[model samples]
Target: MSKPNIIQLSEFDITQKIIESLSNVCTRAVLFSVKNESKDATQIAEELKISLSTVYKTLSNLEDLALAEVDKFIISPEGKKIKQYRSRIGKVEITVDNLEPSLNLYPNTDNPKSSL
Candidate 1:
């Protein structure tokens, strides 16, 4: 699959946000779970066996960091609508030296393995 986009950021605040997202296990799990496909909160919670509330909270946090994004809305046969989230990024590389930080974000590609 072709690469989505490659972005390199040096802004401290943005870099810090990315770092914070990856530092937490729960957030990381949520991020990884939606890497290749979009899934709703319920699906994510079920797959990870995490509480629904926790999944929502985690998704919100990831969204704040631009790590997870709402891909689309799906309508069930019962006429219920659900928001699905996909991983906005595939991989991240952060470097810090002498208090200087830089972040590289790799957007998710069609072939998950291609990003690595």
Candidate 2:
């Protein structure tokens, strides 16, 4: 899989979306889980002890923020395709200037690893 592109969230509209993505505790946990490793949604839920539905919701939010990238799809014996998610954002910087908030994102630099 190709590396995710760096995302800058400094615009007024984008900054709000980024903030909203990281607002939930479950979402933050999901980010931490995939920071240096790729994990399927099931693994994320089990590792974080969060409900699968919550994890899925958080993953969706992160995807919208471009903070989570689909590393690959694993085909199950039943022909089901499972998506492995990795954190595309290696760093997040939030700053407030002139009463306005800005967010800066750094893309993950590490090589992709199997979700095995």
Q: Which predicted model would earn the best lDDT?
A: 1
Residue-level lDDT of model 1, residues 17-108, one tens digit each, is: 66876888888899989988889999999999999999999998776665677888999889999999988778778788899887777878
Highest-scoring model, TM-score: 2
In the order shown, what is each candidate's alpha-carbon RMSD?
A: 5.3, 4.6
lDDT of 2 by residue, 2-94 (tens): 533333333326677677767767788899799887889999999989899988988887876667878889998999999999887677778
Ten-residue segment with the worst summed lDDT in candidate 1? 3-12
Screening candidate 1 with a backbone cut-off below 3 angstroms (N, C-alpha, C), the clashing residue pairs are none
Model 2, global lDDT: 0.75
Q: lDDT scores for all predictions?
A: 0.77, 0.75
Which stretch of 10 consecutive residues in model 2 shows the poorest summed lDDT?
3-12
Q: TM-score for each prediction?
A: 0.78, 0.80
Q: Model 2 reaches what TM-score against the true structure?
A: 0.80
